[model samples]
Target chain A: MPRSSTYEAVLDASLFTPAQLQPTAVGRLAFQAGTRWMRDHVCSHRTLVHEHRVGFVLWSWQLEYVHPLRFPDADDAVVEVTARIRGPRASQLEVEMTLEGPAGVAVRTRAASVPLRLSGDEALSGVPRPLPDALVAAFHDDEIERTAHRSQVRALRAGFERDGEQLAAAVSEFRVHRHHCEVADQWYWAETLGFAAGAREELVLKYGKAVPGLRRAQAEPIRRVDVTWLRAGQLWDLLQVRTTAHRLGEGLAFVHELGLADDEDGGPYAVVVERI
Target chain B: MIVKVRGVLLRFTDYENEIEVGGNTVRAGLAALTERYPNLGKVLLDRTGEVRPTHLIALNGERLTRSELDREATDDDRVDIVTAVSGG
Candidate 1:
């Protein structure tokens, strides 16, 4: 019963890497397809405006690169993407997306999101709302399979901590800014540090560093990413991000935690797990 | 006293647009507000009456924690509540 939608587009030069194709580019392409599907089927912009809701907030993302994609030098490649609303929770929706090219299936992704609704007089004043009845009924009744390898990675947590020091140090900092809060692109938590444009890149770079042999020496493509928004951070909030690496079979797993430097809670503002 | 509700917290309040609640301290102000709109309490505070971990409360632009709920509030002060949201 999952709702499905297809999005077709031509691979643009902007989505390609300077040298060779990269997994991040493929990931972004798949993410865009999922967003398009949400807009068309679940949380349409017209419905949101009519209902006075802010829009969907992506809580987590899991992507897998199945095949390498390259841009044709002469003619643009045709890309077809399909997105499925796999499940609905209390305040969350799970979307599974697939991107296919002329060669074959290129990438697959699963994302979780919450609907943010406006309140009071402020355009930005809003809170996350439970999934609508209509949207919930759009998916199957059974639980959707979890995309991220959370259990496997979690089991290795203690080992990661014990040998973390030997791994390359991965840390970075950024101050939240006004531009990071744009509604259409950033969404509600962008005012804090949930997710915004360019956040994925920052995570990728940090995770790549922590796991020495994980990233390609030359291209450094990312295979998968899982993120958790633990707390809300506001504009002007300074955040410190730290990452630790662990071995997951042939691939490497990285755990990145971000926290507000000024807050004493010691809890993370966000937690990101990257597998490469 | 003016108790301002920001973001999605407004959905639970009785006010259509603007909201103002009166109390002597952050805790009292929120309590009075929640008293008028019981649902607000459920969203803003936990079973133990503490602010939820993912939510933040600020008094006069200064962020506060559940332990600081007893901090003083005045008729002119502004209180803001914010919670975590997700986006791409």
Candidate 2:
């Protein structure tokens, strides 16, 4: 039967900044909620990665700040997180998470992952495999027809690549440290969020004085974000983030692409689009 | 020329981040460096002794194509051996 996993915890002051709930904190919560959902509703992570020799590599994820966020009134307030398995395509599994506080659903996130076989002395393969029968049975057909955010994100990225005018662009570089990696020494997926945020801040610092419209990003909260991952960066890998500012009608948008600093012609490891 | 070994490649280079070698061409420089560290060669090159597609060799700050490996280099040139470690 199809089911949703619920995780609840007391809100902590550390989870917020001076203004509102931290985006990275929300990402961490969503990730943990998804993991718990998998363990309880589907299967244990150990069974999937160790026994099955498979890894759920994220392809794309989207987050929408649905409600205006503010600091909680009570110090002991609680947060409720619900994770639902949305759709399992030919080789992809999707999960949607909602975080509700006193105000109602404050943040909504959806992630799409593809199972990749992981074993042997050879480098990890990028080829995706179909979900196991047992795994497929864990989800239902009700949400199978739901629209996928990855398609829309891809089309937006393609549009930006083709004819979108760039108001300003900046390139910055960093190395993947051990702290940035997961069990396999591959940079954790959430780190992509940080890279994109850093790139956008750098853009504002460098160009906000000239383009006053860019300063609006600093004043406004990020209303929506869409991310697509193409590859993973390993520990010690030198990576670069290219941030481009664009005019989205009357609003402002930022597109960040992370790739190997060495490969100028290769595609990015990830692309992040943020609307402010 | 100077060859800079980074990340996991440093292990193959005996943890030496930079190695000085003598060669006229980019390929020759890499060959000389790998000859000094056979273990590094095994990981960086393929059966045909060509730089593996997974690894990239950059001259100074510019990436060099496979065909451009024969391009000449001087002692002042800096070579970087790079590969993407993060994978999905």
Candidate 2: where is the Cα deviation over 4 Å?
A: A72-89, A120-127, A140-149, A158-165, B1-88
Error of 2 at A5 (Å): 1.2
lDDT of all predictions? 0.56, 0.74
Q: What does candidate 1's lDDT look like per residue over A102-142, in tens digits?
A: 56666676666666654322223346776556655544544
Which 10 consecutive residues of model 1 chain A have the lowest summed lDDT? Answer: A184-193
* Model 2: chain A TM-score against the true structure: 0.87
Residue lDDT tens for model 1, B1-88: 5666543444566533345778789899888877887787776666777766646788876889778989988888888776554222
What ranges in model 1 sit over 4 Å off? A1-3, A18-31, A49-54, A72-90, A134-166, A184-219, A232-234, A247-250, A264-266, B1-56, B59-83, B86-88
